[model samples]
Target: MDQNSAKEGKGLSIIAYITIIGVLIAFFMNQEKKNSFTFFHIRQSLGLWLMYFIFGYVISGFDSWMLTYSFWIFFAVLFLYGLLGAISGKANSIPILGDFFQKLFKSLGN
Candidate 1:
């Protein structure tokens, strides 16, 4: 991305990490600026966040404490990866689901 585009998209990019609220803010913010790279990361972050809640709910049902803790730990790792991508201005996917999110939300931007 060029400097101008990066500058324009910086607000949305930063907003893309505050969980679900950030997702909504980024989406609306991107509407005017419309940076593809920033949009890609926003969509990817949204998917990861949505999955995080789903996984949290599923894990909560498990009776085993160890399993619950492990699940949350894994989610934290993924969240960190997504955050790093947003901060670094790269659409780097979180290990297992990065490509999947890119494909899933491809229509939103491209």
Candidate 2:
């Protein structure tokens, strides 16, 4: 990729990992100027956020301390992993969820 593409990819990827709102912002940002690298990160970030809310709710049902702490730590590690990949302009998937997210959110467009 060219310098501009790499720079934009990194920017989009970083913004995508920020928060749910950042994900939406990055989505629109890429609408006009599509970058596969950035799109890859967007899907991964969205999946992480989804896992956060979904698993968080499910984990809340349990009163076990070990489960709670492990749940948070597990997802935290995944988030950090994806964030580092984005910062490096890598299209690396976020462990298991990476491929699923890409396939699931492919309609999100270029």
Best by the lDDT measure: 2
Give me the displacement of residue 35 in model 2, in angstroms.
1.4
Can you give the lDDT of residue 110 in candidate 2? 46
How does model 2 score by TM-score?
A: 0.91
Per-residue lDDT value at 87 in model 2? 81
Candidate 1 deviates by what RMSD? 1.8
Worst 10 residues of 1 by lDDT: 2-11
Predicted candidate 1 versus true structure: per-residue lDDT over 1-110, tens digit per residue = 66666566766876787779989988887787679777877877888788988988888888999998888788788878777766766656778898888888888865
Deviation of model 1 at 84, angstroms = 1.4
Clashes of 1: 0
lDDT (C-alpha) at residue 58 in model 2: 96
> In model 1, how large is the Cα lDDT of residue 60?
84
- Give the Cα lDDT of each candidate: 0.79, 0.87
**Residues 79-100, model 2: lDDT tens digits:** 9999998887667788888899
